[model samples]
Target: MTQLSLRNQLVTVFGGSGFIGRYVVQKLAQQGARVRVAIRRPEEGLFLKPMGAVGQIDIVQANIRMPMSVQAAVKGADIVINCVGILHEGGAQKFAAVQARGAEVIALCAKEAGVKKMVHLSAIGADAASGSRYAQSKAAGEAGVRRHMPQATIIRPSVVFGPEDDFFNRFAALAAFAPALPLVDGGHTKLQPVYAGDVGAAVVQAALDDAAAGQTYELGGPKVYSMKEIMQLTLDTIHKKRLLVPVPGFALKPLAFALELQPLFAPPITRDQIELLKADNVVTEGAKGLKDLGVSQPTPVEGVIETYLYRYRRGGGKFEPRFS
Candidate 1:
């Protein structure tokens, strides 16, 4: 597909300061697109300014739950992207509120503003019939986008790993102090981990490629692995030898509930997250994917995890033996 030029185009990105959103913003900035990062706190997203030339990237305060804020952000923008999503609900940031309703608001506002193009970030496991609320909400968000803007592009990724990702980083952190890592449901759940950078590239391509409009792409790596294998890989990368204990999903619910009750910013695991683990989180067979969007070879977990997981290694990964 021929890539559309984004030079000098005003693009509004909701949640531009987030893990996956940052990558999208950076790529847009590189393409010379003027980025307006619509975040709840403009000060928190000020760090994104360095990704582009002076005045190339700007931040505006906007909340997805607030229609007026979303409307103000998309005004006069050539394109819009919604990257706002929550892993676990917290207070008013419920899954239905942020993922479902928040998405509807963005799409509605972008359509009202006469935005030509839009790209929405979703997950591969999104299903309306799924037992997990997170997955259900994701499906609802996709439906909302389609309902509001029929031409918008949607990209669904599975287990995105990056330098600041919570997946590998969270498990590695647990291995640092804990004696063992719990493998929910015997760790048999399958997953195809995709790199955040690759997903970001897909998002950019979906935004610029006219062929991608009104299409949904499932993004994943070249290989698939079970939950047990993922945990073992984490241990290998970080040079840790923690036990991999197989635990039933039901057994973990009590502990997950306890974690949910805590006041910590991000709990180790929540009950809702355990429900998410009940099913495999891999791309469906014959689904449109990264390769369809020009990312023929998605980066594997082994290629990127070590870049950041090294910090979790003993001695800060400075004393590794070199055998050549």
Candidate 2:
């Protein structure tokens, strides 16, 4: 057993209602921290209460776009974590507004409130000079945090997957029903899919480790898999076979932009999301990861897919026979 630490600390987690946020909140609660989940809608975060002991968790409304609310959330907290990011944009929720400006809000408020520590979650492909608005906003968000909280630990994780993840399971479900699955750029884009639980554990480790201050960690799984390989693995795990149709970047990219226009109804794709796939979403060379965060080796995609993807299988659960 590891030495118990960070007992009784107050932590404010922005966007704690999200897929990754729930896991991180639970891990923090297990360490005896008083976790305050800050979300735009507190009711949605009510599910987090069961993860902790009585009075160990609370939920409050704190929209990053509203600096005053963010300030109120950070006030009197020992640690603050920013998980507010958007995969696709909508009204008042563009990549720049939420990812870039909102990140700055949390950092600045935390600094003003004298919060002892902070952690920012960013994607793996963050680059200031990148063409994708998503990547650029992430890079900008990191810069904003550093500007205010120079010692904040920034974590850039590759594609995160788990029971609630929309990555592998969503694609697997689609593959189960669709006649053919499109392989963007011949599905050559490399990725290192990390488990959401592992990433959450990394957050707990970083928030408590003073030595991790001001450092950046790039997290990935034990093995790297290409887009096509991941898709195939998804199919194999769900016991479905489908044709892999290669879609050239030139032809498929324009459609991606058209998908971006979907935010008007539902953001099927954003210009930034399309641009993000042009490059591999994996860890950089020699970057600190799970090992540095003191998390055990993350579960590989192969080991985890069946646990959740079973629901999407044709017969129902993994135990259900195909012909039955």
Question: Which 10 residues in a row give candidate 1 its minimum summed lDDT?
Answer: 315-324
Model 1, position 161, has a per-residue lDDT of 88
Candidate 2 similarity to native, TM-score = 0.93
Where does candidate 2 stray beyond 4 Å? 1-4, 262-270, 317-324
* TM-score of each candidate structure, all chains considered together: 0.96, 0.93
Error of 2 at 67 (Å): 0.4
lDDT, model 1, position 272: 85
Alpha-carbon lDDT of model 1? 0.91
Report the C-alpha lDDT of model 2 over 1-324, residue by residue, as the tens digit: 233377899999998889788888989988999999999989899988988999999999999999999999999999999988887776788889899999998999999999878999998999998988889999999999999999999999999998877788668767767898888778999999999889999988998888888899999999999889998898888888899999876777677677656544543444566567799998889888899999777878877778778877777754331100
Off by over 4 Å in 1: 317-324
Give the clashing pairs for model 1: none
lDDT tens readout by residue for model 1, 47-121: 789889999999999999999999999999999999998898788999999999899999999999999899999
